[model samples]
Target: MALKPFLLTMLDQATELCHRLAAHGLVVASDGNASIRTGSGFYITRTRSEFENLTVDDWRWMPVVGAPTTGVSSEWRMHQVIFHQLPQVGAIVHCHPPYATSFAVRGEALDGTLLTETADFGKIAVAAFAAPGSGALAKAVIDDLGATGSACLLQQHGALTIGQTFQEAVQRMERLERLAMVQWLVTAGFPAHQTHE
Candidate 1:
């Protein structure tokens, strides 16, 4: 199917943000994917595509109403499930920021009170470990989304964030990482709780 102008714009934006995510160390070695919904369906990064070198052609268009079973992200199921469940979400970003993934790997839920940004993004939740590209992982993410949160840490995997727009989703991913970094530093040697008193 032909790509619409708006969807093309979103693909370009997603490619740009994907590169930024890689350059900023939020993703490494093709470890993440990003997507934006289109009137035709959803356009997502291809499986194993390097974010640093993503191009418009690297994106695959999946129809929201009748998606095919091929040529999509390995984690297509995750995107499909979430987009299907959350009609309000317009974009989705999945990244493995080091600090945030560390918490996921360590089985630690992000402290919602770590910083104001955390609350602004809503509380982050840690989904139980599930193999990547599996229905189990998709289910875990959906379950996390069922909560009142904007982000979810995929245990032993990475993180996912949804937003009403592509830029918002990207920003939330970046903010999640920043909050995780601050939380790590503070808990390592500084106070465990905020000094808002």
Candidate 2:
């Protein structure tokens, strides 16, 4: 990984974000990856990285194009493709937070009826099913996210969020799952049982 000065602070920030997300039950095991835009490329969490225990050396540098390295996170293509597609997005977060993944596996959209959440996220869309680590998966997410560029639910998978900064992306990921949790609680009559694949 390219250890540029611009990426140094992000290393610590991203590590903290991962730990926080894990503490809040937003991500588990090796289930999530994050990336930040570098001057020339981006540094993504490597495959099998334990988010809560991430090290500064855990990231892999990847360009916007060309063949992706396998040791890096399998979902790098999704981040790369989005960067190429939307210039405004500066960070990406992909995670399988329980509530959102439950909705995704059931092939449902997180209800946009909550005015407060809807006003910000617009609509949380679930992309058509595509095999993980494939370009098709990236395209599916891109298609579902549309031009406005909010968070998206990967069918039978998880959630993806893009923002102008890594902090913003992390917040969006948290918000999406929280919204889904609230919706499930209200509609499913409490008990609060989370079902996921």
Candidate 3:
């Protein structure tokens, strides 16, 4: 089926956001995935897609309720679960940002109180580890994200963020990584660098 202009625009924006994510080091190679809920289903990155060169056409549309298909990101199920359980979430981003993933590897959740940007999220929950892309992972993620939380970290894995728009989701991920970086620096006794701004 032909996608409407609005959907096409959303695809373009999503593609651009992926590039931004890559340029900022939030995602590398084919390491992360994103999706936007459209109508009854959603458009997601294809399996093994490199964000730096991702194109709008590279996204695949899958029904909200359907059998899993091949050639899509292994974590598609996680996106699907959020859409199904959190009716307000219109976009989802899953990535392994270095600092945030470090927290995940260390089995630590972000102290959302440290940064104004993160304060609203409170303490970001860290979901228990489950095999990547498996149903168990999906369930674990949704349980952590719950009905109101906007972000969650996957234990020993990565992080996930949801939003009413792709931009919102991407911003949350970026803020999350920044929060993690600040906490890491604090823990290491790295003196704060004075900013001219």
Candidate 4:
């Protein structure tokens, strides 16, 4: 069956978004995954798909209520839970950007007081560490974000952001990293900089 133009456009935009993340050095190789919520399900990047080389074939349509298929991202459970619990969210971006994930690893959290971009987000909650792709991790994420937050950090793992639009989610991720960077600088004192992953 032929795919509708809007579906095609969604795939195209997802592909472009992945490429943009790679171009900005926000994600490397197959380091992250993204999804767009559809009425019945969602579209997500396939496992092991490199962002810089992503094509439409790298995406898969996943039913919201079923067991995830073999090729879908391992973190699909996290995305699935968020969509199910947060009806207002239309898109999700999960990435291990260095700056933000640094805070995750250190058990630190970012707050809206840090930047104007983060103002509406309040505290960027940090979920307790759980093995990747586990139901426990999914529960942690939803528990944190579901309690009135738009972004979260997976302890010792990465960051996740959701939005009413894909671009909004992507921008939030960017703003998160930027906020982390500035926070580090301000806390570290002047003329002395530290780097992290």
| Model 2 steric clash total | 0
Per-residue alpha-carbon lDDT of candidate 1 for residues 112-172, written as tens digits (9 for 90 to 100): 5777766766567889888998989999999987844678999998899998898889989
Q: Please give each candidate's TM-score.
A: 0.90, 0.91, 0.93, 0.93
For candidate 3, give the lDDT of residue 70: 65
Show the lowest summed lDDT stretch of 10 residues, model 3.
188-197
- Counted clashes in each candidate structure: 0, 0, 0, 0
How do the residues 42-142 of candidate 3 rate in per-residue lDDT, one tens digit apiece?
A: 88899999999999878988877886556789889998888888889899999999999999998988899998879998999799999998999999998
Q: Which candidate order results from sorting by TM-score in descending order? A: 3, 4, 2, 1
* Model 4, TM vs. native: 0.93
| Model 1: residue 115 alpha-carbon error in angstroms | 1.8
Q: Please identify model 2 stretches exceeding 4 Å from their true place.
A: 113-118, 190-197
Ranking by lDDT: 3, 4, 2, 1
lDDT of each: 0.84, 0.87, 0.90, 0.88
